[model samples]
Target: MDSLAGLVHGFSAAAQPEFLLYALFGVLVGTAVGVLPGIGPAMTLALLMPITYQLEPTAAIIVFAGIYYGGMYGGSTTSILLNTPGESASIVTALEGNLMAKAGRGAAALATAAIGSFVAGTIATMALTLAAPGLAEVAVRLGPVDYVAVMVVAFLTVGALLGASVLRGLAALGLGLIIGLVGVDGISGQSRYTFGLPVLGDGIDVVLVAVGLFAVGEGLYVASRLRHDPPELIKIGANRMSREDVGRSWPSWLRGTMIGFPIGTIPAGGADLATFLSYAAERKLAKGKRRAEFGNGAIEGVAGPEAANNAAAAGVLVPLLTLGLPTTATAAMMVAAFQRYQIAPGPQLFAENSALVWTLIASLYIGNVMLLVLNLPLVGIWVTILQIPRPYLYAGILLFAALGAFAVNFTPADVFLLLVIGLIGFFMRRYGYPVAPMVVGLILGPIFERQLRRALAIAEGDPLTLISSPFAVLVYAALVIIFVVSAWLRRRRSAASV
Candidate 1:
């Protein structure tokens, strides 16, 4: 079926009351996670993955879709009112939104953010709906060699673009590759990295790795940096937008969506780049009266970044659905979730699991509306959630991390393994290493190995055959271009800084 017909089918499947409730619950949890500082969607998804064990695949997926987008909108509350960004992408939101709130234009900031997210999300979802089906058709024609190329792009970009330094990101990716390769070899059925232990032969569970790195690891890292004082919050007045606010924000919203969705679909960093680009665009475009507001509580800054952040989130789903390429940490966790159900997301996904894919797309549309409704009128509630002490918040996360690890196989060994991984995560954070590339590598490494093996077998062990395919050559060329461009950009920035 075509995209439009598939969407109709999706709406039919997802519009049921039960699925709606699941979506609602997911958004509520996601929003709360965003409101709480130091907790991110990846960690939230990791901690709550046990829910997938209880609910059916469709229900669990619907809820998760809600959480994904809701988290995007949820950060607006804390970023604006408390100046504490819950996630890296929201850092820009706090930059301008907090100023607005401190100036007692808190209501206007919140209004623009909520409405702008809605506008961007809805438009981006429309783009996804139209774009994904055709992309899936193209992806279906790709061979194993082409898949290897795509995965290489995913790995190289993820490793090079994430974290404080390229070396740190690559190191994290290497660690994940090592851990992912621990199980018995699928082709030979021989133990590879088990070290003669039966437990190692089974390989570490994805749940354990995810919870350790995101939940337990983060908890430990944050605990090491706890402060004695609580942060003061700005009191928000009535949450409503003025006509002038609407006039200024609409253009920024459109521009941010235009900038964000395309970036989200690529591997060159996701929402972070989109937000920065949008912020720059808004600043450059601001006219006479608006120019002076750039540093102090500019509504355009908040509106544009917030819109881009949400639109980029929608854009991320495109590659994930069509090529099984996850561009972010949360997207990697989503891949893990798909694997849990033995449902691979890629070219054949639409042909084999059409129902599931369509329903998921439909849920995105529902989730957009749900978040707008949830965020607009409930500003005070989220602010209240933001006041939660970091100690209690992380304590609960650690507890859930333990529970999730133990629940994996009801084994104490898994829990121990979780702690070991968590410690690694702590050290990574302490040393300016990023955990996202590791998660992406951990999830994609197996897929890459399998694809590589398949390609090699087809070529009868000829290494040159790997690059013989035109698509593979193109992918590598693109990789080189990205690297060169990024390096040049870095040099330019350094020169300007000097």
Candidate 2:
């Protein structure tokens, strides 16, 4: 009953003229960026941080939340039409979506993806509304040692789950931790890793890292792959789904949401894993003809994973809101946004700023509706984004990347750093290393250090205090179990291949 009233209040707040306008603007921009090949929600939010610094807190959050969800809706468009995935989460969508397009069912594929995203997002947002407050209640009781344990689990999962190789994920995480450790020590006044550079004292801006890696690096990588041969675009002949299509997809949407929401709430439950799990689930559940369509362009393939992707997106918000843990790149960027407004999202957030939290939650429902409306009949319009020439598109992206970097402090040094980081990002991509763990590592490393220091301080410099609590012990045990299981599976797979 309390959750119901809270949602009603949130809806009332979200319905305000100013909030509605920001919600609309956010989804629009978010969908547009999602349609673009190189930019993901994290990069888009980072690029827009300068503008958000000038807005009211509620409006800024509404907008950022919209973009985060809207990007999920927009990614399927490129995947189905161009066989190019805008985000790693959408990669599964392309496997079946592009095949559907090739089979002249492009419209159905897009329709299912857009609609499935709506169903999953709406259901998952409701789950978030009901679950977040309760989770925050539980989280409030946890001590600093427990929180540190949670962070460790998050660190382990981020490194283990994101990419093809666990070693590479750990390597990327190590790099991020190194970057995060630079600059003046927060607890002590001593400078660290400054290399005699004045700007290093403030540490590198998360915005610069996000933009350089996602936008600039992506542009360079795409530009390198540009050839004289024009890519083929699958045409959307009929944009309507058959009655059978509707029947087939609705159940998958629900199941995918079921699979996605719970996993997303976990500290390491990323969309990449959620989508894959949803795909595998759907494949396993299908019978005869439907099962055979797994390799073909099956509508179920598009529906289930896309639904899982969106649900997982909503699930990412749960931990972000309740525990102040960011499981996804966009969620990590949002933490920076909260810090910018002098607000921290955690257990205390609900007690201190309940209205803003509810309003942000309310806007998600509105954003989901807006994305469906914008994507459905207007499929042709969104696909037109793909028509832009690579040279021009990439050049514009690089220009904006530079502009966004300079906007941080109007510093030429930041721009130089952006270029250097962009080059590093390009190589990371070229080598098949996942970029997200690096970002996650940089964001979480400082938090981990802060908690570690506090824990030791409370324990009078006893290192054992970290794993002393029952909760801490359980978390560490889980981490070790996961690491061992993952390694065993990898070795088994390797041996079978041999």
Candidate 3:
């Protein structure tokens, strides 16, 4: 009942004219970025972060949330039409979506993607709203040690699960820790990695890193791989789906949402994980004729992955809202935005900023609807964006990257750092090192360190006390079991394949 009341209040707040307009703007920008190759919502949001400083916190968050959903919707467009995935989560969609397009079922693929996203978004949003308050209540009881343990789990999980190799992921995480160590020490007030540079006293800006890695690095990588082959636009068939297509997709959407939402809310679980799992689930449940279409372009393949992507995106908000823990790069950026606004998420957020939290939740539903409406009718327009010349598109991306990075601090040093980081990012990508974990590490490292220190202080330097709490011990046990079981299963699967 209390949650219901809060939601009602949230709806009232989201209904305001200014908030609605911002939501629409966010969806528009997000969809555009998502549809375009080599651009993502994280980069788009980072580019907009400085500008958002002028808006109210609630409105800014509402807009950001809108972009998050809209980006997922737009990402599928490229995958289906151009055989290019705009976001990592859309990679699975490309497999079947592009096949469907080549087979002249492009309209069906696009419609399924859009409709599945809407259904998944709606269901996941409801799950977020209902689950968030309860989780927040549980989080309110956690001590410093518990918080430290939770963060360690998050760090380990993110680092281990993000990349092809745990070693590379940890290496990226170590780099982020090194970056986090640059500022003045919170406890001793001693500058560790500042190297006598005054600007380093405040630490590297998160926005700078985000823009450098996501925007500049991504643009440069794409430029280097630029092919002269003009993208063949998939012919648009009837935009409307037949009853048979609808029947096949609706169940897949539901099943994908069910699989995706819970997994996405877990530590180290994001859209990538969710989509893969959903694809597997769909494959497992597929009937005789449909089963044969697993590798080929099946409507279910496009539908399930698209649904999972949207559902996982919505589910990421659960931890962000309840514990101030960001499960994805975009969520990490949103954490930075919260800090810029002097707003702390977590259990206290619900108590202190109920209106803000609820309103943001409410806005997600509105955003999903807006995206569906925008995507379905504007499919042709989005596909037209693919005609943009590679050089011009990349040039524009580089320009935005420069402007966004410069906006962070207006310093020449920051620009130099952006270039340096961008170069590093380029190398990392070339070597198959995942960039997501590095951003996660950079964002979460400081928080983990702070909580660890606080826990130690409370424990009077007794190391055992760090895991003495029941919750901490339980979580650690779970982590150990998961790692061992997962490793064992992988070995078994490899042996069986051999």
* TM-scores for every predicted model: 0.97, 0.95, 0.96
- Backbone clash pairs for candidate 2 read none
**How would you encode candidate 1's per-residue C-alpha lDDT over 1-498 as one tens digit per residue?**
478898999999999999999989999999988888778899988988865788888888887788888888888888898888988889889888999888889999998998999999999999998898899999999999999999999998889888769998999899889889998889999888888887787888888999999998988998778786887989896646889889999999999999999989999889987887788788889889898898898999999999999999999999998999999999998888888888898998899998998999899889888888988888788888866777887888888899888988888998999999999999999999999999998889988999999999999999998899999999999999988876775564456436
User: Which consecutive 10 residues in model 1 have the weakest lDDT in total?
Assistant: 489-498
**lDDT by residue for model 3 (120-205), tens:** 99999999989999999999999889988888777887777776788888788788778877788888998888889897889998
Provide backbone clash counts, one per model. 0, 0, 0
* Top candidate, metric TM-score: 1
Query: Which structure is stronger by TM-score: 1 or 2?
Result: 1
Candidate rank order under lDDT = 1, 2, 3
TM-score of 2: 0.95
All models: lDDT? 0.89, 0.86, 0.86
Task: Tell me how far the alpha carbon of residue 171 in candidate 1 is from the true structure, in angstroms, after superposition.
Answer: 0.8
> 89-185 in candidate 2: lDDT tens per residue?
8988998999999888999999999999999999999999989999999889989899999988887787777778778988988988899998889
Error (Å) of candidate 2 at residue 208 is: 1.8
Better of 1 and 3 by TM-score: 1
